[model samples]
Target: MSSQARRRSRGTLYLALCGLVLACLGFGAALWAQDHTTWFKRLRGGNAWSLTYQGDAVGGQGSALTIRYRFNPDSFKPAHRIEQLGRTHLPWSVHALVNTGEVARVEVEPEGHTVATCRILLDDVRVVAEGKSPAPGRPAVCDVTTSSTPEKWPR
Candidate 1:
């Protein structure tokens, strides 16, 4: 082959190799961003998380109760507090994000046979954890600490 033709072919091959390398790097970066950022999770679909409280006493006669729980990205902060649960509010449920190293807690005040059961669900299907407290006239506290991120959730 002519020297000019050989040089041109070599340059083309080098450019192609560079392009391939850049494509691989872009793919890897996309994966890393997906794992590390919430924007990517929103693009695909935010992780589905559900916290539920239920128990025998939930349906039975009981006085107004206090409920506390934590299901946010910030694990250092204290659990959110609410006082709307009562005899009529049995089987309370709410949806929120619960990342790894965080907790799903349900604390019901010791009110007239109050029993509290807590459940944490990921993707609306996977049961991450659950707990129950059934002692009457005693604080019914249920806690579940998650250890791992969901398969599709951002780390």
Candidate 2:
């Protein structure tokens, strides 16, 4: 090949290689940005929360009661407090108060009962029952810690 032609071809190949490297770097940076953005959104409470609780009823045939609370992303406060939305099938009324993604307090009142009130605490996977009318064989104020997350609770 002529000297000038050979030099030109080499220059073209170099430019193509450089372009490919830059494109790969750009793609890597974009992927990193996307991953970090998703993490930030979760930390800022941009993701919805689904808290579930399962335990035996206070009385009457020893049936188990399952309570599920769904909190929209907007309803989650920086302090980890979630406001009750509406229209839930929770057997008893619940006051959603979550703290630090670990501790949660829920006030419950059985149906057709006005005097008895109960409080449930979710300490990570552990569930503590308190107040009047607790489950049989379980103390009025007791902690029943489990090794499961709220999402993994039985439906």
Candidate 3:
């Protein structure tokens, strides 16, 4: 082809490339905006719920051996145990925010005369579900399905 024709073809290709880049950028921005909106969050999970995991040394001094918990049921992976070198002190608590309709669970194993407790709370006040160690020196397991709550969502 002639040099003039080649120049024109290159110009068209450059323009097309610029348009494609602009289109991709616009699409990415739209998706990012949608994801940050409330409606998208509600559709994915609804609202954020609160969870608490606690342990107390009841009789003699007690320490927690391991604490296993899940904040999201879909992934269903227990968090890593406390990384402290020695046993973690009792009467300790952990708090987390999870998505609505997800299962909140906590399991605590106490060494010595300690008790483990787990509670799922709404708005940091209403107790959705709670469980304490059956007895001292035993593991306490607590689980609550967020969908079980009678209260409306997006509250």
Maximum-lDDT candidate? 3
**Which segments of candidate 1 are over 4 A away from where they belong?**
31-50, 56-79, 82-84, 96-102, 109-116, 134-139, 146-155
TM-score of every candidate? 0.50, 0.40, 0.53
lDDT of 1 by residue, 1-155 (tens): 99999999999999999999999999999898877776554445434344444432555545436656555643334344333455445455566655554556666554666665555565566665565564655655666665444443443
lDDT per model vs. reference: 0.57, 0.42, 0.64
CA shift at 82, candidate 3, in angstroms? 12
Pairs of residues clashing in candidate 1: none
Q: Write the per-residue lDDT of candidate 2 for residues 1-155, one digit (tens) a residue.
A: 99999999999999999999999999999999976875665556533333343223443323213223332233345344334333223334433333233444343323333223344544333335555544333322222222223233332
Candidate rank order under TM-score: 3, 1, 2
For model 1, how big is the CA root-mean-square deviation? 6.0
**RMSD to truth, every model:** 6.0, 8.7, 11.4
lDDT of 2 at 68: 31
lDDT of 3 by residue, 54-89 (tens): 555555456788776665433233232322223677
Residue pairs in candidate 3 whose N, alpha carbon or C atoms collide under 3 angstroms: 55-91
